[model samples]
Target: MSPIELNKRQEEILQIVKNNGPITGEQIADRLSLTRATLRPDLAILTMAGFLDARPRVGYFYAGKKSAQALGDTMNNMKVKDFQSMPVVVRESVSVYDAICQMFLEDVGTLFVVDEQSLLVGVLSRKDLLRTSIGRQELNQIPVHIIMTRMPNITTCKKSESLIEVSRRLIEQQIDAVPVVAEEPAGLRVTGRITKTTITRAFLSLSESHEL
Candidate 1:
């Protein structure tokens, strides 16, 4: 028999599991305004795709750490590289106020902080901005580098890493987002980004499959 393709509804169901997984079928149905019976097929497909795991009482989770292991298995001894292709980045010199504005304009949660050489020096998030704002500090004088998560310990992902691995890091870190990094002549550089939304979409795509 030919393989089944995921339809739009199946994709939606998959997203629910990825975003708020370990959730109950009933909860999923409720979110979609669907009946349990109506959503069964989508759930079943997601289960088949290895996108979700069902628990007896705890409900369906996003498969938690399994995706990371799967990524390792699939890659075969490859290291989890940093995200270099970050979409939004700002200079360490950029003011918190300006950074906040950029974040809002970009509709992203985090921004990479780059040095004069454009090397990744730190990371800033919406939470950081809010915290800084609470103090009412001088945005123009205060550099984002002061409030950003600095280098070497930054949680990042590479484009080559499997989507599953990326998803795992996002969940485990409990952070809003991650920065992509790449090797540059001067040093490691911020490239792009992979966010919860991206992982959520991937999970949904995996879940919305037809029976084999």
Candidate 2:
């Protein structure tokens, strides 16, 4: 089914119902600082549009899976650039131990590996460092480039791409994050990153935007 298009007020109403329902119409109106009369039309539309369900004594409730689907559709329409987080970067020539320290200091699961020109060259995950660190006494002497996932093999997304596509890549690749990049005269330059945490924040923002 085609998703219902909601105006600001309707979205606000749906959000309220999702949070505080099964709540009375009068209560919802009170939260919005509008009279029940003023809110009647919105309530009617939401009920008819299948975004809400009302019970006689219990008040109103969100329409369950349909509401979830609507939120998912909205998220899918949002662009990756709109929600991508700042990337933690390290030079390819940096030692593996130093890179690990940087990752811990920045509190990120992955780090974008870049060249001297700041062009994206590879990607390094915690797993990569862990595998390399085991039984290795020369971690501080080994460059990250030796173990990083190189370009063309690394999953990346452009700023113009949708969040849906980025989320798909995160799941399908079994990776924690994807670098957001732009094509340059020299190579791909890392601008940002989309991670599982970023997606969680996006969901929270979407939910909070509709709150009372």
Candidate 3:
């Protein structure tokens, strides 16, 4: 991994924190004649990338981790299950019409498809349903299995995978989410779900916690 490259201001902030250990972000900003709000993002990056540590009601302190390796180490330490959301799954036998209703009710962009054995079989997306529903009036009669993107074609993640890697795959494939699955004797078993929103929330929570 490459070392975290910082702009002049970030460098200055680090120097300040190093000199005055445990100094508040507000104080660091004051030294640079900037507002705390302007420094929020820099502080978050520094802390998250492992250059610094933040303590609530206290302040920021340098962690002294090697910049080149800290980012990977910090990200890898965050397990998917620690931040994953509960999965919304539907059976392969479910009707396309009913699946649409479930999607609206659940308010999710994707759904995991499972079989009678509760093993993952496929996936359902709004696009899949819309395409299938275009001229079909028998949505009630048509099952999701007929339209779902099946296994091997579907991208999946494990509970033990890191969020960094999972989020990367989500963007690369241009998919909104992926099911967190476990390899069972029969097949892959859906355990949870990870989405772009879920990752956004996780980062937001991390940044918010370290905000001054």
Of the candidates shown, which would achieve the greatest TM-score relative to the real structure?
3
Clashes of each: 22, 0, 0
Model 2 lowest lDDT segment of ten: 64-73
After superposing candidate 2 on the true structure, give the runs of residues whose Cα lies further than 4 Å from its correct spot.
1-73, 210-212
Candidate 1 lDDT tens digits, 1-212: 23445587766776787887668989998999987855654565455445567888878866532222232342332222321223788888888889999999988888888888888888887888899998957887787888888877688777566656766787888876777778778777676777776566545544334333
Of 1 and 2, the candidate ranking higher by lDDT: 2
lDDT of 3 by residue, 97-160 (tens): 9999999999998999999899999999888888988974799999999989998899999988
Worst-scoring 10-residue span by lDDT in model 3? 203-212
Q: Evaluate model 2: give its TM-score.
A: 0.65
Candidate 2 lDDT over 1-212, as tens digits, reads: 44445668888888999899899999999999998855664675466446788899899999853433455555555677566778899999999999999999999999999999999999999999999999547998899999999988999999888878888899999999999999999999999898988778656555543343
Q: Rate the local accuracy (lDDT) of all candidates.
A: 0.68, 0.82, 0.82
